[model samples]
Target: MPANAVTQIPAAPADEAVRHFEAELRFETDCWDTHEALSQQADPGFVLLDVRSAELYAQGHVPGALNLPRRKIIASRMRQQYPAGTLFVTYCAGPHCNGAARAAAALARLGYPVKLMAGGITGWLDEGFPLERDAAL
Candidate 1:
């Protein structure tokens, strides 16, 4: 380290930061509306997935949601079940859990149209949406 040599660590400019923030905000807004609309529509094109463990899923989950645990998302069997081109909406127990994100990422990588249900199952339940016990495949 030389005192005379000044090293500048590049930081994102205010404008750039704002642009990034706006992009993220737009994405969040879009996802929120999409989730809400999908819930109301209950269309088969939109598949709600419970990305938690089987035990957690059995406890409670979104009505008509498929129990596709995050751990099994990358597995061949689960991949076959979900397949590519399917519109997947994934959720975990709550916001703190990254299981939904992981599941979404895995599905995205596999070429599925995936969206992470913001706020997870907690949000769904809080919205007064119905939940079911032990969803059938």
Candidate 2:
């Protein structure tokens, strides 16, 4: 009998798989969780950042997300705007876009705790969440 593609590669030991998945949760969040946190929590305890260009952001964005372009994620601006130890969640156009990862990396390098919102705008919409329109930074 031939192995199917999924079983072609050996699976990791259960313990190793558990560790890997657990570690991943430390770095990424999904759209639904993000929405719930923002809407339900009195203090969500994290800042949601839309790392797309200002124009794109104005077109539509997650409610409560601040428009901060990835290229503009400088340490000085971050420090001036956000106090130390602030948790930042970054998202971009969607899974196809790397802007969220870029913003998250910049925030991490600047010593801010950061996580990527896995599905970005595409995922948010797919979850049937409404986007705020015409807001400018």
Candidate 3:
């Protein structure tokens, strides 16, 4: 190598790079499509979890979402009746809020599978989806 030449870096291993990319893709896909197919499941293998305060949830939220804040992940009282393998999709006020991420983490720690809704409630609203003010019972 010439002293004046800059050393070039090698490309990442194909398998490693693909696996990483696939992981990110899957997560984003799950987030971006949260509203599109959530209700079409015949067996309903997932639950929409609204990680906001009761007041906020009462104002409006994705239809069929349960108002269970992130802090209540371990309480087990607010969860809807779903199978053990059910996925929990979480959302908050909007992209500016991290409640969805925090809720996902909290749910994971409590042994519940979870995902964050991309853009949170804002994304769902921006997509022109209908919102329900009726709080979950």
Candidate 4:
């Protein structure tokens, strides 16, 4: 070590580095491609949750999506419906709507793996994905 030379300390192990990197990334920052791909796979354990109000959901929403309005997404109920490790993708009106973000946060806080659908229902519609009016009871 030479005088006036700075020794840069190495970062944590690769696993730790990856964990830190992922932590810095917001769950809502995922792209539409990822959401579409996941939706296409249609895993039995995966769920698409619409966080918009009933009125809004009745007007239009992603096909096969379940309406679980943000206000009704109580932590206890969510935990009961979908234990800790369930995979959930939440969406609201559009990129402008914060309902999805709130819903995702609520689910994540309860230990469910949740992702906010980027651009929300608006994007889903804009991309020409199937949309249903008045979900079947």
What TM-score against the true fold does each predicted structure earn? 0.67, 0.96, 0.74, 0.70
Would you list the clashing residue pairs of candidate 1? Answer: none
Candidate 2 backbone collisions, by pair: none
Off by over 4 Å in 4: 1-26, 29-39, 42-45, 135-137
* Candidate 1 residue spans exceeding 4 A from truth: 1-44, 135-137
Per-residue lDDT of model 1, residues 17-123, tens digit only: 99998876532323345456766685757677888988888888777778988777775775667566778878888788898889888877777777777777787
What's the C-alpha lDDT at position 109 in model 2?
A: 95
Candidate 2 is scored at a TM of 0.96
Candidate that scores best on lDDT: 2
Residue-level lDDT of model 3, residues 1-137, one tens digit each, is 64433446656799999999888764543434776576676545677889999988998888878898888776365355554656878889888999888988887776677767787788887887878896453
Q: What is the lDDT of residue 69 in candidate 1?
A: 86
Per residue, candidate 4 scores C-alpha lDDT tens digits across 72-91 of 97877876787667888888
Using TM-score as the measure, which candidate wins? 2
Candidate 3 ranges beyond 4 A from true positions: 1-17, 26-32, 75-83, 135-137
lDDT of 3 at 76: 60
Error of 2 at 37 (Å): 0.3
